[model samples]
Each structure stands twice: as structure tokens, then as C-alpha cells.
Target: MKKVGSFVGDWWRLVSPYFRSEEWPYAIPLLIGAIALTLGSVGLEVLFNDWSRRFYDALEKKDEAAFWREIMTFSWLAALFIAAAVTRYIVSPYLRLRWRRWLTGRYLAHWLDSRGYYRIELERTIDNADQRIAEDLRQLGEYTMQLLLGFISAVATLISFLFILWQLSGPLSLKFIGIDVEIPGYMAIAALLYAIVGTFLANVVGRRLISLNFMKQRYEANFRFGLVRVRENSEGIALYGGEQREMDMLNLRFADVFRNGWRVLFTEAQLTLYQAGYAQMAIIFPYLVTAPRFFAGAITLGVMMQTASAFGQVYTALSFFVNNYTAVAELRAVMDRLQGLQEASDKKPATAIAVEPQPGGRDIAVEAMTLALPHGQTLLADTTLVLSRGTSTLISGTSGSGKSTLFRALAGIWPFGSGRVHVPAGARVLFLPQKPYIPIGTLRDAVKYPDEHSAASDGEIVAALETARLGHLAGRLDEDTHWTNILSGGEQQRLAIARALVFKPDWLFLDEATASLDEVNEAAVYDALKRQLPGTTLVSIGHRPSLRQWHDRRLELQRTPGEAGRLVEGAAPA
Candidate 1:
């Protein structure tokens, strides 16, 4: 009971928000209409059950006129049933689609907001959040509607038919141990007990399905992620001749999927076996119990057929759980995954670092700032530095000496740290990494990316490209393609430089942003930046000695063994 309550609570937490949201005006009416159609469908079934009794009686009596009358009666009932079913079919899926759209938007916002996606990656607690948002939410919306409406219809049918079955039940008299025992509503009692036993057994047989389905989704997502990695790094893998290694790794991932799939199939088979037998028995069990009265002339043929129909409806309603155990299990697994994502997104991490904006300030300050890796190993310890306005500075360090980590700390994204970073309010700062992200779109859009609505004119963009040594790409500014694949490493870096040139940030931090370019091209890019944006503060991380001429100040990260790196003001390395 507690588990059930908890499940309901979790489900409500996920579902109720949509109905209460701004979309509720549309959502509530669709939901009520779908539910109304469900109840109407159930009402139609009751009318059909009554029709069955009259039709059978007319057939038994060989009354042609009465038979035609019931036939006419059935025509309207069938027409109404079909109309309701069709309307529900259209309305229900449309509602589910809208619900799914709203949920997708909400989850996307949560995942992308406040760099929640980055934090989740840093924590490594959630796996394949893409799948959770895409596949799980889709299944959640469909399954929730499917199961909710089915359950409601089942309950309504149960109530409506249980009374009819009770009235038709009469009494069952039996002699047991020399005592007369009379059972009232015997058929109803029999159906309730049968469904209870079936449901219990189904639960026992399919109890493993929920966890298995959960693992199944995980394994599938892992396998897909592996495939995507191979596609994204196909060039590197081919250069290394690592196709066999990749194939082996992918096979292992798929093997997890395959093994879990077999377990699910076997579990489902067990449940299906029991359910099939139970369903077939239910087809004849009604006649078997109610036939004795018909043979004894205690009831007419109409009553016997009606009793059988009502018994079927009542038993089906009571067996709802038994029939949908697999779907229920799947829904539970999806809910668990989505709930995990929701909670993770909502959770605010308690980090020691505080990033604040200083209004009307001219410099960026790092006060007693310390940076650590995820495993608690110190990267930079108790380092205080100030990046003054209108200065060009270069940061250099040995490989793995936390230069980039310090950059992340300044950018207010490195959560595994302590201390404070104060940036000037409304300051436009840009950090360009080594391999710039070339969004799969036009070259103009790529240059103006991270700012889709930049006010840069086409002429400015083309001039920036020419200045960054990408003059050849000026003609293809409007050509839409995967820019990452099309451009070489050096060209991609130049494109990023062009983007930086266009944006003209007050503070520009380049983390090895020109590592791929030749010395002449790199020099040209820097010279262009100095000439065009003379007031911009340039902070760079690079080991190349040629980079020294571009900056007036140099800071190196110095570290002793087993200690965190510290920023030391020094001359550029010869």
C-alpha cells in the first residue's frame, strides 16, 4: 500500500504540473472530453449487454418480427459505439501529443537552464539524459493516457455490470458436511475471487519486468551513444586502425541489450501463459456455472446469455491489472527514469565557489580561489589574481597543470572549487576553446552563433572572415552544411577567430584557440585582433613561444609535487 501511494505521488508530481500550467485551458477540456468519451463507451457496453439478452430471446422463440426489432436496436447501439470509439481515438492521441509537446519543452528548459546540462555531466549521476527526455517522456505521455483511461473505463464497467451480474446471480445452494449452504451473487463472488487470484499471480510472475525494462532502456541508450561516438570520431578511429577495437566495444554494449531483452521476453512469456489460460477459461466458465439453471428451466435463454455477458464484463473489469501488468511495469520504469531527471534538475548543488558581478568595476578579480577535480584532487590552490582592464595577458602551464581549469573557474562554470570571482557587471566576455563549435548551418550563422540574433551585417561578417585568414569562405557564407566536417582544423580555428573578431568582446580568453594554425596565419589573426579591437583584454593559454609577442603580461601555473598549481607572474618562456 505504501509503495502504491508513493508511485501515485511520483506520477502526480510529473503529470499534474501540465494541467496547472498556462496550457491548462486546452489541456483540461481535452482531458475531460476524453474521460467523458471513455465513460460513454462503457455506458454503450451496458446497453449492448441488455441488447444481447433480448436478441437471444427473440432467436430462441423463433419470432421473426421481434428479431428484426432487436436488430434495428443493435444497429443504433453499434453506430453510437463506433462514433464514440472514433472520436476517442482522435481526441485522446491529440491530447497526448499536446501533453508530450509541453513536457518536452519543460524538460528541455530544465536541462538547458543555468547550465544544468553541464552540471549533470560533471556529476555523472544521470545516464543518457537525451534518451530520458526524448524516448522516456514520449512513452510516459502515451502510457499515462492509455492506462489512465483504460483503468477508468474498467472501473465504470465493473460498477455497472456488477449490479446486473448480482441481479442475475440468483442463489447457489449446495450441501456441505450435511449443512445447507446458500451463496448469494455467486457469479459475482466467483469473478472477484478469480480476478484476485489472477492479479496476484500476474504480479508474482512479472515482478522483475520493471527493473528489467529500466535496464533495457539504459543499455539501449548506451549502445546508441557508442555508435554515435564512433560516427563523430570516425576519422580518428580510421587513422588509428581501431575499427576492430570499436567493433568489439560496440558488440559488448549490444550484448548487454541482447541479454536483458531475453530476460524480458521470458518474463513476459510467463505472464502471457497465465493470462491466456485465464482468458480462455473465462469464455466458457460463465456458461459452465449458469447452465445448470437453464437446463433445469429455472431461467429463460435470454437470462442465461445476459448472465454470461455480464459475467464477462465484470470479470474483465476486475482483471484489469492482470491484463495490463506489462504496460504497468513499463510505465513504472519510465516514470522512475523521468522522476530521477526531474529531481536531479531541480536539485541545487552546494558549491564553495561564489561568482558575483561587481557593478561599475573595470577588472576581473579572483580572490583566494581554489580549484579541484571531481575526485577531490586539488588543481589550483589559494590563488589570487586580477585581470586588469585594457591589458593583454597570456597564461602558460605544463600539460595537466590546471590552466584550463582556472579559466573555467573564472568563467563561473567550475563548480568543484572554493572562493570568489567578481566580474564587472554587463561586461561582454567571450571564451573560445581550441576546436570551436561549428553548428551545422550556414557559415554566417556559425560565425554569429551563441548569438543567433547578432546585429553584425553581412559585410562585417565577410570582413571578419577575411581578416581571420578565411577569405576563401566569404563566397560561401550562405552555404548551409556541417561546417565542422567541411572545415579543416586550422580553418575551424580561424572561423572561431572570425566569430571573436565580429563580436569584439571587452575580455577575450582563448584556451589554445590557435593551436592548429600555422605560425603566419596565427600571427595574422592576432595582429588583426590587436589592430581592430585595441582596447580588448586578451587572456590566452598556450605553450608556443611565438605567442609571447601578442601579450604584454605572462602568468605561468607553477606546481610542486603533490600540491595544487598556483599562478606565478613571470616572463614568457623562451
Candidate 2:
């Protein structure tokens, strides 16, 4: 009971936000529509059950006219039932889809907000977040709809059928040693008891299924992610002839999936045995219990048939938990995963650095900054520096000298640090990594990315592309494709530069952004930046000697044994 309460609490915490959001306008109405339709369907079922007794009575009485009349009544009831079912079928899925859309949108917003996606990556506490957002959210929506509606329908049906069974079965009298004990609504009581036992045993047998299912989802997601990784890196793998190694690793991931899948299968098989047996016996159990009264001529054949049908309905309704154990288990699993992700996303990194804005200042300043690795190892020593306006500064550091990490700190994305990074208020800045991130869209959109494509005029976009020496791509601006896969590394870098030009920010920080290009193209790109964006303050991290001449000053990261890297400002060595 405690476990169940915890599960429900977690589920509500995750799901209640949507109904309270702007989506409530449509979500509430659709939910009410579905519920109303479900209730209508249940009403139709009650009418059909009553009709069944009449139809059977008409047949036994051998009254042709009465039988024909009941048939006509059944025709009307069946039609209404069909209409209710059809309407419910349409309304329910529509509700599910609407709810799913709202839920997916909400989750996407939270996951992407405030660099939560990047922080989640740095934290490394949540695995398969892509799956959590995409697959788990989908499952959460689908299963929530199914289980909620099924429960509502079951409760309504249980009440309706319990009354019918009470009326149809009447009382059963048992002779005690010296007195008679009368049990009222015996069929309802019997069905309730049967369902209770079935539910208890089902839980006992299927308790482990929850953790197994959790593992199964993780394993499946891991395997799928592996395949996607291989597909994305197919070029690298092919170039290195690492097909055999990748195949071996893929097989290893699949082994976990295969092992966990069989465990799920076996558990499901056990559950199915109990559920199937419970269901089959339910068919004859009602007849078995009531046969004595039927044989004694105490009730008519119609009454006997009615009693059995009512018992079945009542039992099925009460057995809702038993029948839906697997779905409930999966539902709990998805809820736990989404809840974990939500909690993890809410956490601010323990090593978060503070960035303050200096009003009316025209420079980016790092004051007494100390950056630490996750394990508390120092990456950068106390550093104080400023890059003023109209001066292009180059940062040169050996590998792992924390140049890129410093760029991240300045950009306000890197969290593991201390001290203040002061940026001029309302200043626009762009950070270009070594490998540019090309969103999956048109080349035009990718070039204008991080900003809407409409943010730039066609002429501006073409000019930026031409400045970055990518005039060949100007004609294909409207073409939609995966720019990452189609564009070569050098081309990607050039496009990133073009992207920077289109934005025309007040400051630009390049973290080995031009390293992928040859020296000629690299030098030409730097020259183009100076010519086109002369007013833009440029801070670049590079190793090429050719890059030193373009900048007025350079910051070099110098380190000795047992000490973190320190920034030293001087002229670049030509």
C-alpha cells in the first residue's frame, strides 16, 4: 500500500502540471468528452444485459411475437451500443493525441530551458534523456490514457453490474447448526471476493516485473542509441575499418537486451498463466455456484442466464487490476523515469559559476576565476583578464589547458567554476566550437541558426556565405537536408563562420573553430572576419602560428608541474 501510494504521488507530480497549464482549455474538455462517452457506453452495456434476459425468456416461452419484439428491442440497443463504442473510440484517441501534444511540448520546453540539456550532459546522471523525452513521454501519455479510462469504465461497470447481479441472484440461505443464515446479494459478494484474491496473488507474482521492466526499457534504449551512434559515425567507422569492433560492441549491448527480454518473457508467461486461468474459471464458476438454484426450479432459465452474465460483468470490473498488471507495471516504470529526469533537470550544478553584467561596460572580463574538474582537480588557476572593444585577441594554449572550458565559462554555459565573469550589458556574443552544430533543416536555416531564418535578409545571408567563401551554397539555401552529414568538416566550419557573420554579434569567441580548415582557408577566413566584422571583438583559441598575426594581443596559458594553467597576456610570437 505504501509503495502504491508513492507511485501515485510520483505520477501525479509529473502529470498534474499539464492540466493546470494553458493546455487545460482543450485538455479538460477532451477529457470530459471521453469520460462522458465512456459512461454512455457503460449505460448501453446495462441496457444490453437487461435485454439479454428478456431475449432468453422470450425464446424459452416459445412466444414468437414476444421473441420478435425482444429482437427488435435488441436491434435498437445494439445500434446505440455500437454508436457509443464508435464515438468513444474516436473521442478517446483524440483526447490522447491532444494530451500527448501538450505533454511533449511542456517537456521539451523544460528540457531545453536555461541550458538544462547541456547541464544534463555534464552531470551524466541521467542516461538516455533523448529516450526519456521522446519514447518515455510517448509511453507515459499512451499508458496514462489507457489506464485512466479503463479504471473509470471499470468502476462504472462494477456499480451497474453489481446492482443487476444483486437483483438477479437474490439471497442464498445456508443452514447452520441451529439456525438459517441468509447472505444477501450473494453473487456480488462472491465476485468481489474472487477479484480480491486474484488481485493479491497477481501482485505477489508480478512484483518483480516492475524493476525488470525498468531495466528492459533502459536496455532497449541503450541498444537503440548504440545503433543510432553507429549510423551517425558510419563515416568514421568506415574510414578506420572498425566495422568488426563496432559490430562486437553492438552485439554486446544486444546481449543485455536479449537477457532482460527473456526475463520479461518468463515473468509475463507466469502472469499470463494466472490471469488466463482466473478468466477461464470465471466463465464456469458463476454457473457452478448457481446451478443448484437453477436445477431446483427456483429461477427461470432467463434468470439463470442473467445471473451468470451479471456475475461475469461484476467480476471483470473488479478484476481490472489483475488484468492490467502489465500495463500498470509499465506505467509505473515510465513515471519513475520521467520523474527522475524532472528532478535531475531541476538541480543546479553544485559547481555553478556566477556571471554578472557590468552596466555601460564594453568588454568581457573574467575576474579571479578558478575552474575545477568534476573531481575537484583544478583546471584553471585564479585568472583576471579583460578583452576590450575593437581589439581582436587570440588565446593560445596547449591541449587540455582549459581554453575551451574558459570559453564555456565566459559564455555562461560551463558551471564548474568560481569567481565572477563580467560581461557588458545587452551585448550579443557568439561561441563557435570546433565542430559546428548544423540543425537538421535547410542550409539557409542552418546558417541563420540559433536565430530564426527570418532574422536575416536573403541578401545578408548570401553576403555572409560569400564572405565565408561558401558562395557555392548560396543557391542551395532553400534546400532542406541534414547539413551535418552532407557538408564536409571544412565546409561545416565555413558555414559556422557564415552563421556568425549573419548574426554579426558584438563579440565572437572561436574555440579552435577554424582548425578543421587548411592554413590558407583558415587565414583567408580570419582576414574576411577582420574586413567584414572589424568592430566585433574577436577572441579565438588556436594553435596555428599563422593565426597569431591577425590579433593585436594574445593570452597564453602557461603551466608548471603541480599547478593549474595561468593566463599570461603578451604579444603573439610571429
lDDT of 2 by residue, 1-574 (tens): 8988998888898778878888888888888988898888888888878878888888888989999998899888888888878888888788778777877887777788878778888878788888988888888878988888889999999999999998888787887455588899998999999999999999998888899999998999999999999999989999999999999999999999999999999999999999999999999998997899889988877888888998998999999999999999999889888887887777787666678889999888888888876667787867788888888898887877777888888888887878788889998889999989999988888988898844688889999999889999889988998878998999999999999888888999999999999999998899988888877888899878888888888988876645688888867556
| lDDT, residue 169, candidate 1 | 81
Give the range of the ten consecutive residues with the poorest summed lDDT in model 2. Answer: 557-566
Q: Hey, what RMSD does candidate 1 come out at?
A: 1.4
| TM-score, prediction 2 | 0.96
Q: What overall lDDT, based on C-alpha atoms, would model 2 receive against the true structure?
A: 0.87
Highest-scoring model, lDDT: 1
- lDDT scores in order: 0.91, 0.87
How far is 569's C-alpha from truth in model 1 (Å)?
A: 0.6
Q: lDDT score of model 1?
A: 0.91
